[model samples]
Target: MWATGLGSGVRALTTTRFGGHSRPPFDSLNLGIHVGDDPAAVQSNRLSLAGVLPANPVWLNQVHGVDVLQADRVQSDQEPVTADAAVTTRTRQVLAILTADCMPVVLADTRNRILGVAHAGWRGLARGVLAHTVQEMAMRTDGQSRIHAWIGPGIGPDAFQIGPEVRETFLEIDGRLEKFFRRDSSQQGKWLADLPGIARWQLLQLGACDVQWCGLCTMGDPDNRFFSYRRDGQTGRIATLAWIET
Candidate 1:
């Protein structure tokens, strides 16, 4: 587990691909049920994870859109909500975002006890998922609280190669975003995109004053600690979860 150190009363962490009952490719500790891992193994893994949490996390369908759900309002028996982000002001309500290579972002206003988690891929970033999550948290605090964000493990700038259209999507949003992309020296007409850098920029722009990154790369995994979709297309997903410690 990688802790975010969000502060005294906040519990935020991202799970690595270790310590569970999955087989090869999915390996062990695969929390995502949709990734072709054995349902029994995935359930056992989730149960093991719940043993360390204050409550079972509220999972999302994560459509790579800007929709943010209220965790406190969700029913535990209901199916996973179709949203890329979730937020809560209620204590012990854990919000979870699953990802392989996509960035897992956790936000907290320790002052107001507001927590949020987002799954931001290139598409979600361009669609303003981080901004939407920040806005939702702000609404709960009446915009008086200062939000801090932690960007968990993801595909780093050097390992994430993209085409011209992906670069153009961000640039079209803000021409200044060109700084987050650079020509891939090895591949002609390809660009190395900075997923974490862009997320940090967006968080700062959204008034999240303290932005931290795990600085771990999913695709560049030398130890096989993380599950990377780009690195291993058939791999499982690791989860990033956050909640208020009641």
Candidate 2:
């Protein structure tokens, strides 16, 4: 399910499970450092990835909240920060996020002036991670710059069931969020959530020119590509990366 494209000076790739050396639960190609995979193994896997890509990816301690990071300066954490996004203007410095079910979004301007990536789960989406990322990108671009966003493979709407708390979040943001919810078949209080729709809505709100989505359902498809947390409890992570290669 990994894909790549080149436009202006930007080059990007979203990695699937075809490439690493992690074990069964972690599988092969596990890029997450926080997962139970051995530190040495994780390091080796990442180093292996570096050989194919342009630069070292900027890994984040994603906490499903609204904080966003700048890739030029990243730190080792005593505790994971409450951030779900990262942006950068530097060339060959990759900004990446690890995700299982959560949406991993990559954005780049046509001028290659800036690039950003975000891990937007329900919590971070409700809190405005996309909006914040666009704002951060704006600081580097002129007012005329427009963001081109691509929505990578994620848990599709049919598989993402949520409770009333999610409904409450949409209501809190705007009463119109109810339109995205529909009753789940197996559960009474739970409704199938539309994560991709919500993410597209957020990106539109941010004035992105082109929004591309893979439309691949990670949860529904268990082939050799993605890692779905909701489907596989003790699972590995896949990465979506963005950077300016020019």
Candidate 3:
């Protein structure tokens, strides 16, 4: 969500489709290589992002699962590890997760020495990606330090209508999760689930208090300021990244 309140030595940002060289569908700043976009154009866009980062981003081949990894353990940039989230205590090790309609959640410890970024869609949320990430990051710090998390833009609750099974997936975890969903009158047997709300609950349960969200809905913006894979079937992905500055 590009929050600065996490304090010094912490750097975080989420990209939109405003600048770069890819053509329509992936138009201009498409940083994801798995989206069928031209490889060179994606590389060019990655370079553009690199200019602002302390080091090259350790991008993930996000699979809507709960797998979380240490950023330094990732062996290659050419072959991104298949994980939905990444965490690191090392400086300049930028942790990145790409998304269009899925939520990107970033976390910072009180000291700003540890950072984590996660990709959470309905599947990942139901599978506990947010919980897994917080557990990984919190384990690195002592009991007294608080964890802060920010929810980056994705398809907001107003636009994220889902089927009954999707709702069931979460309710199965905790009946209290029912508060994050509402019946979708527009679509029979469907509900608009709050992706950010689910993540917020997960974060708070893990003792993260300073949780903030950008409140931007990729599908709701008519101007196409951000990419929306749900609004446009074939589309580029925007990136949300986090890191500790040297």
Candidate 4:
């Protein structure tokens, strides 16, 4: 577990690919039920995770889109919501985002007791998922909250290779994003994109006063500490969770 340094009133952390019941490719701690892991094993893993959380996390059916859900409105019996991000001001209402190479971002406004988490793949980032999440949190706080953000593990720059079209897509969003990509010498016409850096830039642009990153890379994990879809075609998902503590 990697905890965020977001001060008091909030609890946030990203889990590693350890400490659970799944086997082989999904490994011992696979948290995703939709990833072809055994349902019983996934349930056991979730129960284990829930032991440490304030409440059972509200999972999202992340589609790499920009939709954000209000986790406070979610009920325990409700099915998983179909959104990439979730926000809440309610204490102990856990918000979770699962990832395998894609970034998981947690945001907090400790003063106003707002919390948010987003599943940000390149597609979601290009589509403004972080922007939408920040906007939602701000809206709930009447646009006066001083938000802080913590970006969890994902593929790092040196390990994330992208094509010209992918680079063009980011450039189309913001010409300044060009700095986040550089030519991949080993792979002709391919670029090494800085996934976390782009997310940091986006958060700063949204007026987040403080931004931090776990600085771990799933794709570069030789120790198998994290799950990486780009590193392994079929793999388990690690989770990033956040909640306001009572």
Badly placed stretches (over 4 Å) of model 3 are: 75-78
Off by over 4 Å in 4: none
Please provide, for model 4 over 155-177, each residue's C-alpha lDDT reduced to its tens digit, 9 standing for 90 to 100. 99989999999999999899999
lDDT of 3 at 7: 56
Q: What does the lDDT read for residue 219 in candidate 2?
A: 84
Clash pairs for candidate 3: none
Give the distance in Å from residue 208's predicted Cα in candidate 3 to where it truly belongs. 0.4
Q: Report the candidate with higher TM-score, 2 versus 4.
A: 4
Model 4, residue 136: C-alpha shift (Å): 0.7
Model 4: pairs clashing at backbone N, Cα or C within 3 Å: none
Candidate 4, residue 109: the lDDT equals 82
The residue pairs found clashing in candidate 1 are none
Model 3 C-alpha lDDT per residue in residues 115-212, reported as the tens digit of each score: 88899998998888988988888778765656788888889999998999989988999999999999999988989999999888888888886898
Instruction: List, residue by residue over 1-246, the lDDT tens digit for candidate 1.
Output: 655657777888889999989998898999998989899999999999877788888989988999999888987557999999999988888889999999999998877889989999999999999999988888887558878889999999999999999999999999999999999999899999999999999999888779998898999978889999998899999999888886
Please provide TM-scores, in order, for all candidate models, with all chains considered together.
0.97, 0.91, 0.95, 0.97
Candidate 2 contains a number of clashing pairs equal to: 2
